[model samples]
Target: MYNIGIDLGGTNIAVGIVTKEGKVLKKTSVPARAERPFDQIFADMASCIRQLFAETGIKESEIESIGIGTPGCIDTEKGILIFAGNFKYGKNIDYRAEMAKHFDIPVYIGNDANVAALAEVRAGAAKGVKNAIMITLGTGVGGGIIIDGKIFEGAYSAAGELGHIVLISNGEQCSCGRKGCWEAYASVTALVRQTKAAMLANPDSIMNKTPLEQVSGRTAFDAAKKGDKAALAVVDQYQEYITEGLADMINIFSPEVIVVGGGISKEGDYLLNPVREKIKSRVFGIGLLPDRKILPAELGNDAGIIGAAMLHA
Candidate 1:
């Protein structure tokens, strides 16, 4: 049987027909148009799903379930999107019920980051692992935790908010309205912020060697590779903050694996090696420290869609 997975993001909605073995048989993308009415976005989504089925020549009788990964807080049991900042029109929408009404199939929905992490655990990087945590260091840091192969959604369905955890006392403010959150200093946006600040501080530095618009994680990597001191320093600073957060997670959860995903993870060993080393060296319970291995996410962008599909399982 086939399963349908939908990645309902801020910009676009991606749908796919996935196999039981986690292979995507067919996939397509359509504009989310979140600025428009919720009904319009839902209609686009329905059309996308129907197109996917037609392309795959799969009938409704052959489908097992449909899973949706949406941004923001969600009431999984009720299939309601409580607060999705990306979609101004999605708040309080009963997505599962609506989708079920249109498709007549079992529907499952959850927070996007949580479902992405769950997908990696089930079929991506963390496959075969019993316990792990996932961190997506993107525009902001998003987190998810898996224990015994199941996602640990806290009592309020907001568990695994690793990024919002306090790292510094009354320091940088976060989008969550808190101060000194780990994400404020460890995300890709944070990296860019740090890079820009450093460049401004040392106008003569090689970072000023590149155009501001071209500055990104890769830019930092390129400069570091060229032995640019300022860029190296920025990377060092970012990694230090990231390590502190991971070390705390290691101490608390003792997870067997930590899967780092998102654009920053493209740095691969450049990012994972140092974070792993720092966690190993600094964590409190040294002897009892779990067999923590930091690995890059394998599924890339598809993890969210694939993971969302498995929510019904």
Candidate 2:
């Protein structure tokens, strides 16, 4: 009658009872306490699940399975959390086996971004598309690729790392010890850095009114709206960086649709329209194919949870 989806993140763990249609019927959350031992972390997870079932009066027999969307590489076949930047453990945290010990239902695991992409394709922006990519512009750029109505994890479940792709040669350094990574240029981190740099360069820019520590992704857009030349320049440069990465992805996969999500995505059409234009003309062989559509993600944070639940699909 229902499924359970758990979104396990560095700072929080959210559990939800979901319907077959990908609707979250009941949900609860707690601090992730990620620094603790993996077993204790999972004990917290199991406890949260028990609380949700009790509150909703949902029985184990009525549940089809339990799924988790986590931040890191995942071995979907074995339901292991291979490696996560924010997670304390590294390599082969047997999440499925551990969670299964506490529940009778099948347990599955997937990369958080991949599961969110699945949710978008199944019930959000790309609902009817057979192929799509979901890009999240947060502290860093995160992505998920979908093909033929299924999540494409690639061999070793390490594919779809769209952000790590090199965008410039010998360019900005990335957290992954690489240079010119798409993330280093197009992520919110880069945007804020760009905004601050611009503010410092032009002391009279409208952006100067904002504190240096508060130069957010929106600073440029807001100041640009007020006709600040410095701010507008930053917005233009950031958009160009984003477009370059998107064009590369289109050239590689050319998915039928791209769903952009995350904090910066709240800019909506102001962001999608320009990126759409660049991708349309820049992707290889664009003269023969229909324009690939770029749409904002519909499900927001719930995409991961709903998608995790649908892992059994």
How high is the lDDT of residue 126 in model 1?
88
What lDDT does candidate 2 reach at residue 126? 94
Expressed as tens digits, the lDDT of each residue in 131-182 for candidate 1 is 8999999988999999888889987687888999999999998988999999
- lDDT values of the candidates? 0.86, 0.88
- Clash list (residue pairs), candidate 2: none
lDDT of 2 at 307: 93
Question: What digit string (tens of lDDT, one per residue) describes model 2 on residues 197-232?
Answer: 999899999899999987788999988878899988
User: CA lDDT of 90 in candidate 2?
Assistant: 66
Error (Å) of candidate 1 at residue 171 is 0.6
Which residue pairs show collisions in model 1?
none
